[model samples]
Target: MTDIGIVGAGAAAAAATYVIDGALPDASITVFEKSGGLCGRAATRRRGDVTYDYGANYLKDDDDRVVDLVSTFDDGLVEVAGDIHVFDRSGTVSEGRDADERKWTYRTGLTRLAKHLFGATDATVHRRTRVERIARSDGAWTLTDDDGGTRGPFDVLLLNPPAPQTATLLETADWDAAARDDLLAATRDVDYRTVWTAVLGYPFELDRPYYALVNTDKEHDVGWVAREECKPGHVPDGESVLVVQANHEWSVERYDADPARNVADLADHAAALLDDERLADPAWTDHQGWRYALPESGLRRGARTPAEDAGCYVLGDWVAGEARLHAAVRNGLDTGERIVHAR
Candidate 1:
């Protein structure tokens, strides 16, 4: 029987382990991941000889905890000077001081960051395990898998799943009326926007700026166009990779449409913005949808009832601030510290 059981293998869970291990050295830790791999939204995909960051793009230096954690890894990350180009609806590219701020990305891909977090600890990470329900019985917490298999009577249980999915899990578990109401109340007001990322790879370079942050008045959206070659180890000398993020409004309008057609249309729109018609055709192209891409509101109140008296905690970017990668990591570290202090 493990002392602590965590749901999800994202940064939050990894940070929780880092905290719990130090606080409760004798306790065993186990993390259950629904997917076949770790890194929930921080996903990376490889195409032929190039790797693409399909999920998170980069991290800000202002995030202290995140910076410290990332520094622990030896992966090559080039410092990005804010020399970004912001294109408005009129096709006017404005140059500003905002481009001078520093950012960072992996030389290979975002997966290197996930692997670094996982390597920091010895937590028992179980991939491909879908946690269906979490309940407290006989003074201990029981987590059930999809097949109704009971995992254990864990002393503590931490839930870090996305807010929408977390609501479903809380509904299945037996809890006091007030506790359930509080959990529901805290999450009810939180809304999220969906993001559609269209990734494409080409054998030739488009002789424009490396990054184009576009604001479209027609769609009232923000599209982030990044040159993959700007990062290290992405492609060969002449080839380049590009990623376009559709604005919230545009993504919502076509959230349920055919993915291929949606990607084609988005690619066309992006190509028009860049004045490069060649982008319509690429050697490789794909689209990924993020349902809960950004958090609408911050978490209302602290203190979540963790499976009866098991003393589990809840934390995520929603609780800290926006749904940025840095915020998530900060929330995770904070949750870990709180758990440790409680112990």
Candidate 2:
């Protein structure tokens, strides 16, 4: 059996695994994920009766291939109900260029997208298993977790973490130094925009024409505010949930600040932007800080050759040259096809 190992069980990794499983049904696939959840930044959380997606927002149906892939799942898949409005740095809201593009998320949450993809595969996913080291030996790859547990000598290895985390793994990999160095440098070239997210819940309802309001000008402290209730089956009747994301500068500044303070501050920003004082005092709140939230740039394609030749593949939004969920899935599909072709 061809042994395949994957690091990070994100959307891209799940897609790749799905494709690989379909093509090579007997391939033994193993995955290591550092977090408790399957999807990385395409995260979803539920508290009581409220479900919200606080990171990466909705998955846009931009790529036909990704659209076709997700449609096949068909379970719990949902369309975000309203259009996206825009706001200025001064907090003036207006009608945005409501493009006809379809925006999607699962009724359960965006995380269900990854769950559906991975669920269809035969791959074994190890959640909360942090891989600390990678080594190449005897024409195979091996991984050691933080707990000192070792997994395989796999024939192929796929990395799906953010560029920085992937680079860290490459930095100390016991492989051909030159090849590893080249791949490491390429991974390092990717830069990210941090995001501080606050999920605000209220006991009442929020009636708005648009599902979300985005800052057209990047100068605003808050970057995006989305209503979770816009997605069906997410928020229960008469209860509103808002996912507020702070801009890169503001996120970087207060990333380590007190969580309560940061949540209150973002709630204040939301209150001003929405022109509702009641929003400033959310009945309940949750927060998350994404240090490598969005990639500002993609990795250079040529930099991947040496590593791929060594039986290692990298797939993610950064490698796909776009920071969208669809891009990540598309990249995963293409990468899986490439691996199948190589085999």
Candidate 3:
């Protein structure tokens, strides 16, 4: 049986896991995730009875394969039906950028996308298991966790971390120096944009024609403000939840600042943009800081050459050169197929 080891249980990793498991049913696939959650930045959270996707608002219906995958497996799938308004740096809101196609989400949130893909496979996923060291011996790969525990000489190893983090691993890995240098250099060339998000909950309803407000000019401190109430089961009746994401500049500036202050500032920006004073102070708030949230550029062509030669593969949205969730899934699918064919 083929033995596969993967690090970081993101969307691409989950997609790869599903495809690999299906192709080789008897294969033993093991996954290590540093965090307790799956799907990486396509994150979700629950506060009492409320559930919201604070990271990625919704998946676009642009890709047929992703659309088919979600529709086929996610029974709780729900489409977001309202238009998205544009908010400028001047705090003016206008409606002209409504999406042509539907925005899809689920009752349980975006994390369900990963869960569905992984649930179908027999792969064993270990959460909160941080793999700190990577080593190779006799043409086989092994991983060492933070607790000094080692994972194994597997036939194949897949890396699903962001480009920068993946570069760090390659730098410290006890593998071929020339191959590692090539991969690390290529990975270092991949750029990323950070994002700081704030989730605000209000007891009263927000009477807005649009479900979200995005900054078209890219000059605003607040990049996006989306309403969770637009999703079917995200918010309760008569209550509204707004997810406010700061722009790249704002996020980088205050990434190391206090959480409470950042949340308040985002709420203030939202209040001015939405023309509602009530949004300035939410009843309750949740916050997340994504240091390497979105990839600005894709990996270089030669980057994967070295890894592939070493019986190692790296796949993610960044590798696919797109920050979208669909791209990550597609990358994983293609990577899985490549691994299967190579075997």
Per-model TM-score versus the true fold: 0.91, 0.98, 0.98
What is the full ranking by lDDT, best candidate first? 2, 3, 1
* lDDT (C-alpha) at residue 308 in model 2: 87
The lDDT per prediction is 0.73, 0.92, 0.91
lDDT of 1 by residue, 149-250 (tens): 998778778887888877788778865556666776777667887888899888897676555465544344546677767766776779978888887877
| lDDT tens per residue, model 2, 73-181 | 9798999999999999899999996567789998889999889988898889999999999999989999999999899989999999999999999988888757788
Worst 10 residues of 3 by lDDT: 95-104
Clashing pairs in 2: none
lDDT of 3 by residue, 22-130 (tens): 9988789999999999999899999998999988788888788887777788699999969998877797888857468789888999999999999999999999999
C-alpha positional error of residue 160 in candidate 3 after TM-score superposition, expressed in Å: 0.6
Q: Pick the candidate with the highest lDDT.
A: 2
A best-first ranking of the candidates according to their TM-score comes to: 2, 3, 1
Predictions: Cα RMSD each: 2.4, 0.9, 1.1
Q: After TM-score superposition, what is the CA distance of residue 236 in candidate 1 from its true location, in Å?
A: 2.2
In candidate 3, position 1 carries an lDDT of 81
